[model samples]
Target: MNPVIPRLARLFLIAFAGVVALIVVVQIVWINPGKRCEEAGNWWDWRGRACARPVLISDITGRVIDTPEARAAAKDHAASQKAAASKAAPEAVKP
Candidate 1:
């Protein structure tokens, strides 16, 4: 009887721990979807209005859209990807 009780306790603890871990994972997946821009080696997920990171589809010379409808009509039709590349130009920073 003692052996059976110990085995049952162990099983119960394992199952409980699994449930808690699952909950945490679900929270993380749902919280952040698009984290590619914020951090490298990660992908973006724009689902259900959940964004793990922001997407800079265009250069950093635009306005900040703060509405729920984050659709940009200008960024998609741009011809200056090199503009953003020039942001790292050390020559311009000389004082």
Candidate 2:
């Protein structure tokens, strides 16, 4: 009865399981929108989003960078918002 090989295999399986569990917990707790409903106005707003089980989940890392197209879109969006804001406010009252 070779007990050593069996014990080593068991240990490896346990460590691998722990790592998997840790990753699952991180994704659920941090990145999953369903878990972060407190930051919203209504729960239904999350309906079509990733919380509806397994879509292309974004990175959990806080260092998420915009893709090239996304970056361009964001830049355009910000510029539009800035222009709107400037137009909405009267210029500095000539103080």
Candidate 3:
């Protein structure tokens, strides 16, 4: 019955428990969300911890799926919104 051996064994058990707890936390917090996101066919933003739909560009035959006209319309709409915001910003700054 060596006292030093028991102390070393206790330290090893504590270290082992800490490692297991850390692994469980990592699996729950970091790994599971990314796995779920992939299974749902969405892009995972790791830094933001959010899932986003991927943009489809074209089909296998080179036919464009995301049409140019649709893009232009979106651009025009964005420009209009930006202009409106800018106009409101000046009014908001007035005393």
Candidate 4:
């Protein structure tokens, strides 16, 4: 039985265990920046150091409601309101 061989094997095992523990710790505690940005959705712009949601250029001018779909909706809403108003109005009575 060689005592030196057993000692060397024990040292190797200890070093391996230390490395594995370090790797596990890093995996558990590390926060991935890219993952958070991706989860935020397509509106997020992750170009800079911090993750942020950029406002559209139209948003600044309060024109974000000017999409084709919105315009159509506005027209439909106006038509309905006009019809409602007219319905509530009294018609002329012919005596």
Top TM-score hit: 3
Alpha-carbon deviation at 95 in model 1, angstroms: 69
Better of 2 and 3 by TM-score: 3
**Candidate 1 lDDT by residue in tens digits, 1-95:** 57999999999999999999998886666544434333654455646543344457444657766654454544443435556657757777888
Sliding window of 10 residues with minimal summed lDDT for model 3:
56-65
Residues 1-95, candidate 2: write the lDDT tens digits.
79999999999999999999999986765556555653453342343544332232344445544689886887798799999899867865555
lDDT of 3: 0.86
Residue 72, candidate 1: C-alpha displacement in angstroms: 21
| Candidate 4: residue 21 lDDT (0-100) | 96
Q: What is the lDDT of residue 81 in candidate 3?
A: 100
List, residue by residue over 1-95, the lDDT tens digit for candidate 3.
98999999999999999999999988887789989998999988887878888764444457653788987987798799999999999999999
Q: Give the TM-score of candidate 4.
A: 0.37
Tens digits of per-residue lDDT, candidate 4, 18-76, equal: 99999886554443554666577533334443656766656787765658998799779
Q: In model 2, how large is the Cα lDDT of residue 1?
A: 78
**Which ranges in model 1 have alpha carbons more than 4 Å from their true place?**
32-95
Ordered list by lDDT, greatest first: 3, 4, 2, 1
TM-score list, all predictions: 0.35, 0.36, 0.52, 0.37
lDDT of each: 0.63, 0.68, 0.86, 0.71
> What are the runs in model 4 whose C-alpha is more than 4 Å off?
31-95
Off by over 4 Å in 2: 34-95
